[model samples]
Target chain A: MGKIRTRLGDGSFIELLEEEIYEDLVDGTQDAAQKGRIPPLSEDELRYLLDLYKSKARVVGVDEGHECCLSYDNMTSKIERAHISVSKFQQLQLFERALGADTLELAHIDYSYKQVKHVVIYDKPNMEQAVLLTIPPMLYGAMPNLGLYTYPDGPCPNPGDLLPQGKFDEAKEAYAQAIELAIKDMIFVGSELYEAGADGINFDTTGAAGDAEFYAALKAAETLKAKYPKMGIEMGMAGEFILGMHGEIEYEGVRLAGLYPHDQVKLAQKAGVTIFGPVVNTGTNESLPWNLARSVTFTKACSEASEIPLHANLGMGVGGVPLNIMPPLDALSRASKAHVELCRLDGL
Target chain B: MHAAHSIASGMGGMRTTGDLVARLQLNKGMRIEQAKQYVADKLKVPVTDLADSVTMGEMREDLNIGVVNEAPGVAKGIDAKFRIAELLDLDINCVDMFKDRVKP
Candidate 1:
């Protein structure tokens, strides 16, 4: 078993017992189910599963001996302690508040781990203070070029339209500048490039046009890689292709194999694409429970077969698990931790 | 930040009694249908009667099922009911009613 060290609220530290951790996992799963939350695996079930990978698993619970304290500086110095049995609904509310709506909606909550009895709170170098900054396309009016993209139907609109557009030359410059800024901010892990459709070279043997889009996206990724050589560059084929679109038959017959082609994975590995994943989830209904499970399973299989570091978008409504029912934040956190551990075990 | 947030934002602007019941946290009642029945039985009235009382335009409009802003007078009644319900592990409807009645 691996050991993890974490800081507590009172500037103290304590180690977490595996038994307590397992209990928390069970409670988290039950709470999530009661609250109608969507998670990859139930907390308890995941805990049991993690035990199978105990040799490779290392978890450190910070502030395990102290009370969970949340500091709110609104007039008075308020501290909210963790509840004994946090519900999934409460977790959803906290996630929405802490992570913000856009980020929460964009990212999927895989699993979380919590201390069963002790509330660990961090004050210095707060890990909970992290924020997700999205870098919009630089082109003045660059639409996401959704002509070949597939999206699910729902209240949430397709974000493809959020891209900027302008003269191709100007757009390239702007994209370059955006990449530079992203690198500076340490947020541009890789480029999420769009392809014309599943028929494009990125996903098929046709080697169609729209090389400009792919080139631009690829160049941005390369530039980032040159600066952060040790960092990863992930090339997202069009959302449609990654999603196995172009009809079910197309998906079953060719698109599926084409999307995760052995050659492309090898090519990306050679090209120094540190991590690559076909963006699987997009649109509103795309984050359904079944979709999430299928995507995780597919991504895991792809990673194992390709021997490459592949990550699913797992953000919000796209390629990530969707939560229809809200659970306690503690449960969600535990569930997320479990999910990440599972992914590691399954090589996702 | 205010109490009305529960009714306004939390409830997604739903005004019907069924909607309110469906959103409330109840132990035994997991689904909307079960919640409706639970509320009807607890209120000592038929499901239709309870629904009608909750759905009546005048009553629904006047009822403030929102989170309370002030505590002294407005939140006390709801707080008492909430504390009791929580202590006894009872249905949340009792607290909801107390809060609704206290809403001006």
Candidate 2:
């Protein structure tokens, strides 16, 4: 039998035997099931993947609704990084006029709220046309970073050094301190941006540093929402499951660690998040069929449970899209289509 | 410059074939030599030609997967992926199923 052409989760082009495809689908579903404790794809859904791969068309599309609007996390910075040499506002204009992005985010290259807190003056001029000021609640980038708490840089003993000595409490104490610092920075930056004529504030890539980071974002969101009732806030998650890096962190009585997208959305709503971007990590070795099925299943549940708009994170290494920095459109379109069609997505 | 080129510039230049070779090595566990050979076979180019940016640039332009230099109004980003899908004969499963369910 001839091999069917397909792409790996990393967006690498490859061909595989029919049996290999089946094996990948099963493995991918089981992987998601084990990790999230969620139901696997139904047999019919699995058959859909098998038939889709066996189809003759190379590139494919939905007959309708592929032209849906998009919302971006770090819109202007991505344009500037591409060496576009345009002003930040012009980059937003380009996305609106050329790329048709419905909503745009104006952000600094540093990309973290702690870093952007010092640069809101520069970002203020770019606030027009439904633009949100975006920044990550990057606990890892905060002052006295975990590294600073350890080693030659600071007076405190190194956590890594302490961990081997069974100083788990010391290591966790350092993380707890970092989370408090990050929350302050996020609230400060978000308030500064909101006051500067911005339409919204996006806490991009929340939970990247795990539960402590997620806690900081939720707390910051709660504070900011109470302060400015009209300011739109979007919390885009870093992964499907919040990592238990600082496993003891809680937001509003619900523990932050190990919460899946469905559960995560509930916390976001309680914290007054206006939009939620739930991510499903892609497996580099799995086929797109497996990845998309897994991502959709998780995101569908998230969308159903979400009170806010569900802007599923459909980008590199997440959302069943390939891990390519410039994700090939085949995967992007297919992933977007599936999320919109199968899941109740507001934007990609 | 085409808008897609502008978008592609920051996201990393049209390194589609090179990216493919690298992913095969990194993800598929192919050795460097094996990955290069595999990419060469799929792309129908000489193995040595893979590293030649000038040659690869033209090949990418021709293939419409993406290009180091922009060809005005041609594919890039999502448009490029459409061409890549057909050129590479990739089965984007969602696309296939959607087409089947919707077609006359």
Candidate 3:
């Protein structure tokens, strides 16, 4: 009988049971994949496609989001701590006291990074951070496992209470600050650690577009790109504005995810985002669905609108499903390959 | 850079073996012993702990978590359309669909 309270995209909060979240997330994903007429990736397929993806894709990467790094204490000594004001220091203290990054920093990958020639992205706590940063931290003390990132389950922590709608504007401002902090934190990792090893980044995962968070992510990616030209950036979002039969409508298909908003696609282009990934969302929240058709449509629409590479993904960048959790697929069944192929096709 | 096959907390040796096999299958010519050593050294455990000594099939059967094959053994109406209309990119009432059914 575990209970949790979290915020919705519509700026509301709901109390839900752990089993309910699992049923909706884990079970729902399996059921939706079945309904979408997609088969789970077999082990052999996963293996072969992973091979293909590694050899053929422009970029192959792994996400350790700052929490998962095994070598944190050492890395901490290595990282250049940013100068902090007393106020910001207090905020950091609050977060540090509750749900600090200490437990998650694995400290195992030091040699592996040296041995494996690949890209790695750490979090400025990343999206999980964004969720927390969206509201003033003082208002929301980390209640154990509110939403994502808490682990043994997810990255979510109890988001605490929603700030008044009057505070939504303040939340927006906080979003920009969150993006700034992520960039500032990464500057310490520098190109040699992250950029030299990695390609793009999981900029942010905001379910909707045209919000302060999405706009801030775009601005942040643009800011980082100016510093690291070779760095690619990817964002997670959903929508496809369906007006009527006059627009790009299916004759009789049921692709329920939101159509890509025109302005948001423009934002991606402006952000110089290397790719765009979908967060596997099918529950009746303000999120997208786990439908491949929707993925295809999103790629087509975003590519046409933005004229940039659009790579489809199973979940929000990191903490989202399928991306963070496994899809109903065997290890060898290359969900990564599907994304690479989608990027290739979308590029065309 | 894929973490798909990375060993996780509380995973058993059999599950670890499946990831190792998946890694080998993904990268041709990669040696299993080297991978086992890599994992073992990182986790500070012995190579035997990763189940490299066992068969993947045995690992597959013993795995506690779900996999592609472990997916719900049900399908949509067998005769249902396999793919959505490729061009159905119009803006629709996204939220309403969730009320009827959620699928992200």
Among incorrect, acceptable, medium and high, the docking class of model 1 is: incorrect
Please give me the total number of clashing residue pairs in predicted model 2. 2
Best by lDDT: 2
lDDT of 1 at A137: 7
lDDT of each: 0.29, 0.63, 0.31
Which is the better candidate, 2 or 3, if ranked by TM-score?
A: 2
Report lDDT (Cα) of residue A110, candidate 2: 70
- The DockQ values of the predictions, listed in order, are 0.01, 0.02, 0.02
The C-alpha stretches of model 2 lying farther than 4 A from their native spots are A55-59, A63-68, A128-164, B1-104
Per-residue lDDT tens digits for candidate 2, residues A174-289, read: 77666667777778877766665454578878887678778878888899889977566778888888888657778878888899999999998898777678999998987897
C-alpha RMSD for every candidate: 23.9, 16.4, 21.5
In order of appearance, the predictions have TM-scores of 0.28, 0.69, 0.33
Q: Model 1, A58-116: lDDT tens per residue? A: 33211111111010011001112233354333332343333211011111111001110
Candidate 1 regions exceeding 4 Å error are A1-215, A219-266, A282-289, A306-308, A323-339, A345-348, B1-104
Worst 10 residues of 3 chain A by lDDT: A136-145
Best by TM-score: 2
- Considering just the first chain, candidate 2 attains a TM-score of 0.87
lDDT of 3 by residue, B1-104 (tens): 12231221112222233332212211111223343455445445565444432343233333322111223542111000111001111111111222234344
